[model samples]
Target: MVQGRIEKLRFIAEEMQIAFHLATNLTDPFFARTIARHILVRAENLIAHARGLRRPLRDAGFDTNAFHTAKEAYATEFEEYFKVARHKIGAHVQDFDFGKRIELWNDIEIVKLSYFVDGAREIYEGLAALTVPGYVPYAVPAELSDPKIVEILHQIQRSLDARTWVEMGTDSLAMARGNTSAVLNTTPVHARAGQLALIRRWIALQLELRGKLAAYPAIARLFKERIVTDIVSFCDCLVTRPVAADALQAMDGLNKLVQAENQSSAAIDDFVAASHFETDLAATRRVRDKIGAHLEIDEAETLPMLLADLNAFDLDKALAFYDRVAAAFNKQCFAVLFLRMYAADGARLYGVTMGHSAVKPFAGVAEPPPAAPPALPLINDEQEYAKNLRRWLDGDENQKGTARDFFWKAFMGSDSIEDIKETEHFGSGTRYHSHQFRKAHQFLLDALSDGLSDFDFKGVLDLVMSCRGGAPYPLSEVLVRCAPHAPVFRQYLICHVLGEIGSEPHESVSDFFDAQAHSPTWAVRLEAVMARYKSFIKNEGVFRTNHKGQTKVEHDALVASMTQAMSPDERLICLLGFASVHTGPLAGVFTTPFNSNYTALQAELEMLILPLLNDDDANSKVAMLKQLIQTHDYVGVSVHIAINLNSGENHPLYAALVDACCRGTIIAASNNQASRHLAISYVMKKDHRFAFEIAGPLADRNPDWIDAQILVAQILGEIVGAEADARKRVSSIRSAYKLSPMQEAALAAVETEVQNRVTRQEE
Candidate 1:
């Protein structure tokens, strides 16, 4: 389902691009009908899944959650179209039948629309035009053509593949009526003649291109550039003279002559919708006829006319044309809003895909990520950019003068006005180094009047600040100069710059209590404060982590340092973070964890958490305290593990919590739950040797270890428990410690009494 949406959105983008290019429509917002349907279809699928689950959940008493989820999803399933049904394109686009573009638009207000235009259009167009299957007569599988040519063919093929498609280029003309750029209607007589002419021209070009390709397939990239030459020529021809019916007739004759010439697939693709020419030419003609019926223009008027004069569209003509187009643009009614619809055509063209070639394309193959292009020249991007900005900031010597001169030049936009206002005080002689407040003020005024890229403005402010280190540059003036409207408000780099000098709503925030209120753009100012808030929020979280990391890193050193110099309790807390780092086995010296080494660490760990176990703060950390209690219950204080713990900083609070567990204090439990909640964590670390511990607590408790053991025994008397099974598992360790020196000494007096009782019972 996800894959389907991706493909559908891709198709929508392709359709939108072709429409935008054809109509030159920068004002209209193109929305894909296919994409909306896909989104709806996906919403429905979610609703269905939710509904299916709601029934079972209802039976189990969780139905309310399921029902609400399903109900909401169902409503959202179709609200997109219904919700956006107000604007001209928005309303019409929501309609099931409406297509991608409206007739008028250009570059001025176009936002996302411009993104769809490839910066590399020339490169791709160049590659596509000459993608002929058999250039010099020898033919292999059409797909086996040159790699670059194959890529080019894919680019053109995918453009017109959208559902509910409209025509563009020659296809539009062929159809005779459609939202089209230009069209060609091949009358039977024109067809024969044009085919012959096209064939002769096609053969000649093919032989030349093949020779070029054979000589250097790598450079074969140059031959296929889009028709820049053709467009320029046509524009010039149009400017040279007004069109007449006779001229139109002559143009028609010329098109007819070409129609007779080209039967080659490559030449066909060079025109619009060429990839589909083989199967859909006649169908295209039908669609064009439908569009023409509505446009009031005659079908014949849709065709592009050929011209003899190619140099007519010179500098003056081009300027005049732009002026007229610019005047037609109504800012209030329509603005070009750039649209960024990710077509991901390259990924689709190259990746494993589904559903294009009937059932075959849908075969079992997963999509692969698109290949990244080889390294193009990284080129002198920033350097050249900076130089251009320098020229803009400080007027070019040939055009104007220095930075001060450039400011006036930018504001006036004409040399005559600049000349009238020119003063030595505001020209090449002006220097920021003098710390002249008036000059700085003038510079700021000049900057505001003459528009500059964000980079240039930022550069100017930085340079000024550098010149006057201790000068009375107020915070208000500084911010007004650099962050005026706050476009880079959230950028930390900008924040850092501001911080170095000082600004509002920060450590020095009180100084500009009201300066921020007059912000031009709310979005930009809000982000500045948000950036500061985000910084503190981020660091506080980091502080706790650093604490743990530092604790871990210092653990080993602490343990060693305290070994002979400090008491056991003082050294124990320092080892907590390190002990937590590793939980598994180590080399041979100490055997199993049950060895005396563990008993020592276990004894020490108990002493650590014992003192604070009942403290209010420790109790407040119930979860951590509870785990500490459990660790003590199951593994006891592991002094063996404690000495080995190496501290590193990952989580300071985590290690700190462990420190509270091992050293802060001990918990005195009046009930079983209290004693069962310790945060002790222990594990076997020694190698194959008998590694383990002999457990005992160092401190006194409300219910001591012996007392707790008795309680377990009393509970056993009342009911059978895991004790019956636990005894068997502990038998080996219990036996080993059963007659130890400490045990024997304590049981010495009971030995005779136990023997007498057993003897009497046997009798």
Candidate 2:
């Protein structure tokens, strides 16, 4: 009878445990409510059963001290609450009286219930406020309502069941099967191996899963559809076979350890009994045997069908199971290997623990330390290159070949001429051979004998161009070196190369130009003069600006470097280059148009160039104006010239210049040239009539040009009785374009000017 009562109590405890587990683990809110109700019912039942079992066990001559202790604790903590909960709320809900209910809101009507009053608290409070004579305000104790009550009941059941097991001789039977304290005759080496093997499998599974997860996105991006499909299939195969198989093998290894340890505990047994492991392992083996290990002809088991079968295997649950099992072994037996450590450290730890070297031995003596890389020769200076070349030519064939290989690798990054086309210094259209090296050698020998002549200059140029890879020696260094020795006519070729390459202009190149600028040959002198300005304009950072203005240090350094006295033509070229710096691509983006720094720089440059523009030489003035028209700076330079033209004398020249600047492209009126036109238009506002004449055509031709539209509208407002027309035109332009703050300011200025003009006329 006592045993039957104990069994009944155990059964109640197990039912409550199941309800509690379901309540916590199940995620559906509706199901959660159902499980919560079930847990309450089960908890009430367990309490009743435990209360009844105490007396029967005491009468059966069993020690009832633990039962008395549990009963006392229940009475002190949960007895009154459980009574009220069972009698008034849960089991006897029909017996409790509730006030007439009004339907305040329904779930469908309420968007969110949390926004309303706390229903449960209100119900309890209302119950407490009832005018019953002996009623005490009571809330269900947290302990009774909590799922943890089920755990307490389970512990009591376990204690009672353990005693019952002893009374029924089940403990002895388990002892007979295997003594818990018995030591194996030998260290369980095979069991340890199984443990390590399981760890290895786990590590492999983790690595495969992590690698595929990380690589799939990038692989999908970089590969074509067919290739991506194949790669995805490969990844799926890895996960389906190797990773899944590893999980299965890890389970088997864990089971082997349990068998080898010859000890059984509830935790380890619970892990072994988990049905998901068996289900998943069976599904995994089917995939491995049919699709992965062998491509079998089974229509019933397709790859997708087999893969879908694995959906039942929860990898997170499996990992938790393994961790639980390891913890159980650590507590019950000797310390087990830390599975996480093995998975994290990977094969390095495995090999070390297994007494194997981490590094695999090579088959032969390690390849002789790689031959030292060849150093680039110091040939930046022409004199240095000449000395090096003379020494190389004087050497025997082997030395000469070594020198050639060094130069070839330095210039082309490879000694073989087969890769010459691949070098950045060479173009696809140019075919080269090893013989070019020989020709270069002969040319250098000739040039060193008699300063480089026109005939041999081509060979030298080819060599210099081929070797211009921006290494220890670059095009700038080579040009500076070779400029002094290059023939007078070929100096222009060097200048052209320097300009084309766009490297930082070397000071020595400038000095060479200064010397050649006075050359007796007119063509040489002309080339030298132009090349000097070109080199200065192309120098790194010469024209680079931020939103502020030109980089002051670079601008100042460039100005200081202009030590050579300039002719009127040279000064014109400089002005053209400087003026265009602020008008390049996205001119307003890099430097604000007409910012103070830019205005100051312009004033400085105008002081130098305006006098030249007024030179008595008509041919020179015409030549300079034509040069400006042919370059990118034509609009900017012409605008500057037009704005600064003296009021009386050069008005015709200014008009002609503006006409030439605006001649070719109407699109320029709406684009980069718009800013320059806007500047000139603002200056011409002093003479509103002239401003209208200049800006009217542009505004009419490019109706979208906001600056021209604004200027024309402002000029019209300045004229008598055109106020309404100006207001209508300005409003239309403002509506059409999304004006920048500056453009908006210009529009605002136009309005202010129009208002002030009307005021002045009225006065």
Candidate 3:
């Protein structure tokens, strides 16, 4: 279902992109008009399909916040506009009132008007000749003509394209493991051969490493310290210090190699000079020696000054130089050379056979000893096999699967389970008891709760799959047991399996959700919230029937009591559940006994939840923001935060809110919820420069977006007026007008303060 929705969205986005291009780029009015008619139709389809993705995506345990945010932004900005255009102009033209101004220009002379025109006379004359002024059949609104609409359409398409890529990559991995025959049939023979060869080399490398490590521990330590640790630190630096610090760290590491009091140091120095990193190295040394390592009284450099000096240094080139030096050091000192391989090329190389026949034998090299075969376990009887299985289930996480493999090998002995059962040495009537299987299942579940490696998790999932159609276990009980601190994937899989089992509504499931509703992991909390909503809808008839005898006052009292009993986090979850039902697939189909509308329910919940934002708990504040995002009340919540910022009450809560909002906005550039709030907060603090810096780029990027222009204009008015830069103030207002001419009225209201400043200056 999720895949179908994703594909539908992809199809709609692609169609929208094509329609948008045709509508915008076509010169012929006929073609433009024809394509323009379908523009809103395609946009409406995209919106519906995009919204349709949320339920299925949530069901699959994927985060849909970004998708949800983008869809809401698109819909909030364009849904009504498109609806009106589609109804009045695009499709239902007869419903439109073109008004009294639609008339024929019967007395106008086209050639004379063109001769009097200042420029582009031929084009003007051509247009005048083609113009049919009487009762214009279809007039596209200026709102639909703005280029920002199409640009946003393109962004939506790009977002879907990225999502589809992720889905396809995930599908490929699952398909390769679950259906080898399908993969084999689909993959090219040469590619398969390369894959096989690469696997052979990998196995050979593992064997070689094991043999070498056992034979010589000293060399392995050298490899670990010199090669592995160095490379790991280098990679860590890349992630932890992506900007100036990365360049500084790379220089520091190179300096150690250069300053060593040995012959190799001289060689490394010469290599650095040869690589043209000498100047960068020298500058780094000066900064470190003069400012960092020792604070000389004569040195007047600050940290920012040092950073500025290193700003011109090419970190990429420096990193590359370091790589070359490391490789040379390895080859010279250890007689080994490293080579880089692209991932695709490496995967392809797996198919090649690593045999003497496949490669020419090297001269003057002795044949190495053959790798020893793996040891097998001694399982003399069923008791021993059972003991080994138990041991495997209780074994070290790192050594997982060892005893299981041994037990399975010894017990099966090239025979099926049925075959072994029939030949069971005078045990013809043997039968397994449910308690024994249940006990073993309990052991597996316990092992999972303790946490397993990915390999062990996969094995456990396989075992769970084998028991699917039999008597259903207390899987919800297991979920409750593991919900507190299990791995996220484990929690998700447990939830997935519970859904698959279709277990009856049980106390254990509800308990699991109630406990997990406040889980630290957002994904787990989201799953719990969604599950609660689904459970509510699934039992809607039962709930309604049970409450039929109660009056509205009694129902409201009962709901209030239940809500009062919940903690802040639980109330937030309850609020999210209400939102899901309100916006969900079955929205409007189900109603409360108290006859509360979605808006009232939402507002009531907000009244309960919003107060907790000032409760001196950062977690509570952050959870509120996340719920706001889910409820499509993020912007409003941010505005509330901005209002509070004016009061200057809670510093920690303000910081936490801003941080969460910033992270939320990372999902898409179009999501300026954080920036808008932050700018407002800064403006209230009287830091107009900071406000302008925060809101200016949003206005530039979304020039035609009225809200962004208004925000920037407000910030700029304060900033420019404070400085009393009259010319700059006038330019700012004019630029806003030029960028969003259709939004002149809105800009006028925002720019009124700037106009007042200009008027005072003129006086």
Number of the candidate with higher TM-score, 2 or 3: 3
Q: Taking the tens digit of each residue's C-alpha lDDT, what string does model 1 give over 1-763?
A: 2222222222223333332332231111121221122222222233333334334445544324433543454345234332232111121111111121212111112332233323112212221233322112221223233465434434433443332222232211122122222323244322222222222222233234334344442222112111111122222211222347466212222222233444222211222121122222223223222221111122232212111111222323332222221111111001112100111101112111222121111112323433653342212233433343476456533322233232322222211211111122222454222212343344444553356666665665554434323432332244444444445432322433342343222323322322442345432232233333223222322433545422211222423533444344434533342232122121122122223333455455556655433334545533443464344332233322232234422423334333333321222223333232232221122110111111112111211122322222222222223334233322312221223464443333233434454556579
If ranked by TM-score, best first, what sequence of candidates would result? 3, 2, 1
Give candidate 2 regions above 4 Å deviation.
1-469, 472-474, 480-485, 499-511, 520-564, 578-763
Candidate 3, 154-206: lDDT as tens digits: 55434423321011111111122111111221222222222222222222332
Comparison by TM-score, 1 against 3, better one = 3
State in Å the error of residue 326, model 3.
44
Cα lDDT tens digits, model 2, 294-376, are: 22233344434533443343334333323333343333233234322222221111001111112111111223332553344
TM-score of 3: 0.25
Q: Residue-pair clashes per candidate, as listed?
A: 94, 0, 11
lDDT of each candidate versus the true structure: 0.29, 0.40, 0.40
Report the Cα lDDT for residue 472, model 3.
39
